[model samples]
Target: MKIWSSEHIFENPWELVVRAQWRKYPNKFNQAVEGIDVVDRQIDSKGVLRSHRLLSTRWGIPDWATKIIGSDGVGHASEHSAVDPRNKTMELKTRNLTFCSKITIDEKLVYSPHPEDKNKTCLKQEAVINVKGVPLGSYIESFVCDHISKNASKGREAMDHVINTIKLETVELQKEAKHAMESINLNFDI
Candidate 1:
């Protein structure tokens, strides 16, 4: 078994960081994540939004590991998340569904406003890995943990790209709306 944890701070506001997280897929930075499907979503009585998602991913496993596992490296994981707007907090938990007999990876993440800077967001992440019935289990666990650390950096880059895209889209929409208003005013003046 291996445990890994990390903390990071994003310069963007908490709301924008959380928003970017929802749209983090399909970006150039994290190509390993192939797809995401929302399985369920709802709002609770206290106004917290809850969501369950299934993620399809290819982790770029080594050739030797693939040979040992006797299968393609493609995998699926189920994620459950909760967002509390009132408190400006987002929490997510994910667990692998594939290769359960040989290995299991469980992850947890939390996003919240930075205590020192309200405009910044702080992310806390932890992952646990266990390998059963596998040779060199400890080595495999260490490799997975290292891969996760690298992927976490890519995840941040992806979030930055998403946030930039969102800002650009917002600006474009505003310009379009302004143009429509001007056109309507011109028609009225005629």
Candidate 2:
């Protein structure tokens, strides 16, 4: 009924992070174990299947959070929209679930010329993700988290390589500039 999950961010070219979790259901569809009467099934404009979170509101919350926070707390909710394939004009509301766990990543890096020397380069950076404990539906969350973490790690590696390459290019440019000045016999006034 309960699951554990975690996510990590990687240092990469494009921003990326990975997450992992263990859950009972594989995805949104499997959440409803007991054969809930198929009230409806349809596709929306975007061509996505829509389904409701079958679990009762109470079961949706993680057992851990409830123990610490003591009920009376609202869980996180997600909404998805899909265009009805039958009508094409009407949109179906598919896949709405409440989760307790949450994670976010923030990356900010820049490469710029040094303030005093235009030819010199500088690298600035700050990146990380903050995650909080939350209830996830079965093993579904775990599967997704693992996949994301792997992708993020790869991205981080690529980004680090790019940063190094940029640094080398900056140094080469500075050297070329110096050589050009010497070839022109430019006299330094100061």
**lDDT value, candidate 2, whole model:** 0.38
Which lDDT tens digits does candidate 2 get at residues 15-95? 111111102222332232322233445654667455433323223446785777565334322322232333322121222
How well is each residue in 18-112 modelled by candidate 1, as lDDT tens digits? 99999998889879889899999999999999999999998788789788867688899999999999999999999999987888999999999
| TM-score of each model, in listed order | 0.94, 0.29
Per-residue error (Å), model 1, residue 43? 1.0
lDDT of each: 0.94, 0.38
Best by lDDT: 1
